[model samples]
Target: MTRCALQAGALYESTSITYTPECLDRLRKAFPGDFDDVDEAMRSFDPASAPAEMLSVLRSFTPARAALPGAAAYFHAKALEAIAALSMRPGPAAPKARREDRELVEQAEAVMSARLSERLTAESIAGELFVSRSRLCEAFRRVRGSGVAETLRKERMDAACRLLSAGGAHIADVARAVGYARSSSFDEAFRREFGCFPAQWRQDAV
Candidate 1:
């Protein structure tokens, strides 16, 4: 996921679970579709349909810097369970339909990721994507579980946090860098988003 796809200061770590050729083949059968690249594969997935167990695992996961003795086997078992659950989804899979839905959301996310430092509105983004404002909002809500504005705000706040952590930049500079028009406006929004003023957050970070 891009920085825009997660909450500010959130870090996602993927565990390395070794699988044999046979296991890899099985997973290939389960997911089935030739993806040109990792991004293509991810773009084809619908996060909304990810099973509750898988979601829970992802949400509660912590980085394992040192591998556990049975970790591979345990992860393999969970993978099989998740694949089984995903496979049981009713009706013949209309992959094309799902891909279309995923693509709409992915495209919007790509645009937002690329332009987070600019003043973006639903209308501006919709116009760039050649979709209506309502349609763009719907796609974001369906896929990202939030509206475009909310995503943009989070991204901006996260970026500000990173900048604050680094230390040295003036608040006004940080405000403009994240697309706010004025430091006072940035201070208000930052307080609302982060529960502290920028200066206080910077002090804590230092």
Candidate 2:
């Protein structure tokens, strides 16, 4: 998992548990094609996305407990299970993710990051990159473990949250800036993502 401060004074907290090389090999074998080079994804994955059962099991373990006799094996197994779940790709396995796919994902990410204020779709992104939508989506899922549309929705929501937290833009303007043309639609989407309306979230954020 990763975290970024939204601004100069912003605070973001996160935690990560790196697997042993042995565990990584186990995960790679378990996930197969989609698990290659997962260490290099530019996009940050939230740990909250991990399976609840795995998280619960892993959470009950600690460094001291992991070192205890007999417990080490159990903890390592649970940790491996959690990472395997976290590494599962969204789409069906096609082939071992290619380095070219990494390049394509990077290009697509750069385009999406630069164009969040504009309406974007798989077709438009593929057109901009001169690649097929299937290739783009497949590459994106393999690299980021998420679909393009889902990732784009998250990008827009994240941008909106940053704007909301900084305290100047009106709700409707925030909506438009994040590519939603209709305030009502933006409001609905915002609530679906964050469980609150834009105005209410802004009030809490600032």
- lDDT of all predictions: 0.62, 0.69
Best by lDDT: 2
The model with the greatest TM-score is 2
**Tens-digit lDDT string for candidate 1 (64-165):** 612666776666576655544443323223223355556877887777678766766666777998988767665665566555666667777888899999
Estimate candidate 1's RMSD in Å. Answer: 18.0
Checking candidate 1 for backbone clashes, the offending pairs are: none
Work out the TM-score per prediction: 0.51, 0.55
| Global local distance difference test of model 2 | 0.69
Off by over 4 Å in 1: 1-97
Worst 10 residues of 1 by lDDT: 32-41
Taking all chains together, the TM-score of candidate 2 against the true structure is 0.55
Q: What are the candidates' C-alpha RMSDs?
A: 18.0, 16.1
Summing lDDT over every window of 10 consecutive residues in candidate 2, give the lowest-scoring window.
33-42
User: lDDT tens string, model 2, 72-121?
Assistant: 67876776556545544234444567899989988987887898877776
